[model samples]
Target: MSQSAPYALPFHHHGKSKVRVGRVWREGNVHHMVEWNVNTMIDSDMEHAFIKGENTGMTATDTQKNTVYVVAQRMSQRCTVEQFAIALAQHFVRTYPLVSKAKIYVEQKPWARVQQGGLPHDHGYALQGTEVRTVYVTYDKAGKLDVTAGIKELSVLKTTQSGYEGFLRDQYTLLPEVNDRIMASTVTSTWKYTSQPPCYDAAFNAARGALLEGFLGPAKGGIYSPSVQFTLYDMAKILLDRVPQAESVFLNMPNLHFLPCAPVGSTFKNDVYVATSEPHGNIEAVVTRRTAAPHVSKL
Candidate 1:
């Protein structure tokens, strides 16, 4: 039933995408919830499905979608998104002999417990802003596994103690140098772990805190940001110093501009500015220990 062709199938993977699920755990009156958008890809030896039009060994995409819900349901204990992703990935490789490897990507929406009269409500939750926690897990039949966790769309800003100056200028350069200006960015950070930490949530908190602290510095006098590039490096370095389990950290921070502006009758001052999102500077870097292997981001 097979026909030979000049082309060869060297790499093939198939699965489902955007399988959304919400899981909640309850302890007496207290409750916790996680809403994840999951995507799964399975690499398998199913060349026959392509070359010979065979469907016998192929796993349906619907089945893959159902597996995500099934795996989430089977998780009896509360677990981090990384743990859930790893479990779902391992399930495909172990359950299907044809599957050589499985990769899972999960994005968790931020939902903070609502406060009622200075106390957190037991079951009430409010949707936090655009920020989301993300994880990518890969598992192979040979036991090789990789996990990368990240934070996305985290918007931050500072009113002062930032500047850009003394850059190579050419005829095309029209921007002027300033000693003090507003710095803002929507940060996307990812860290790869050398080994699973005892508590993923704690590790995440440490990394996030480090990023914020590095950017804003102390309350008395904030740190001076020479440029976005300098701030990106500082944030990554701080994250590595705080997260021992993380072998490396990758940060993508776009320098969103807040242009100083004033009405025709009023003079321009630092207090008045116009916020802008597009036409921004893109800066990214990866910081890792010298001894650690070169870190690759799969997210």
Candidate 2:
């Protein structure tokens, strides 16, 4: 009888991560800039590297990091984060015959042009808080492609017009129901495209606008949010409606609690709150069109 292998190499993938790059393009006196943190991973048949320490088929993580900068340099001035991710994914799979599949993840820092008097400055920029635009793309040698775009650290809050009630009570329950309360969350959302959009920047903007509109309702009178779950569903639904190319939307909105506090020898009138980040509620869901096929996200 032939000797059998001691261990099975069931699955393996390797790449570089957190490769930060900043690219600037100049048009006369104006300049445009983008900063991205990128990560790359590739799936290939490299069992020998694990079993026998053969390194011929392995792609170095440093090489993967260089590839990100090289691809970014080749991109056009108008390139979006989604486009860069797709290009990087395609490059790995096409360049290396052993690479069967490649996945690229990118996060863009929000930087807006600063205003000089009342007009936008030509070359001055300011970081826009903590929010970021994110993109994930995967490509295979067989021409399979998947793309997802999203927003991260999108914080929103409303003082009133939100409440939580009618929860399942147990013997250990100590919370009380209220008709008015502060609602806040740091939203992290992702939406998978059915196909590549013509303009990724436009598609992202539209989806973000829909999410904000759905959450706040209108400028005059905001909509009442009965629960975080209800608001999450509505946000996803609105995004799908606004962007036809998006097949599905996934939202992760944690309830950042603002507990009401009363002053010394004073009655509580919902006037004060003790904001807390930890021990908060987590609410998330996926919304899709009725006819759209189900999507299995790798995020």
| TM per candidate | 0.96, 0.96
Q: After superposition, how far is residue 72 of candidate 1 from its true place, in Å?
A: 0.8
lDDT of 2 by residue, 91-117 (tens): 999999899999898999999999988
- Give the Å shift of residue 185 in candidate 1: 0.4
The TM-score of candidate 2 is 0.96
Off by over 4 Å in 1: 1-5
Error of 1 at 38 (Å): 0.5
Worst 10 residues of 1 by lDDT: 1-10
Scored by lDDT, model 1 comes in at 0.90
| Ten residues in sequence with the least summed lDDT for candidate 2 | 1-10
How far out, in Å, is residue 149 in model 1? 0.6
Task: List where candidate 2 sits over 4 angstroms from the true fold.
Answer: 1-3, 293-299
Error of 1 at 213 (Å): 1.3
lDDT of 1 by residue, 160-190 (tens): 9999999989999999999999999999989
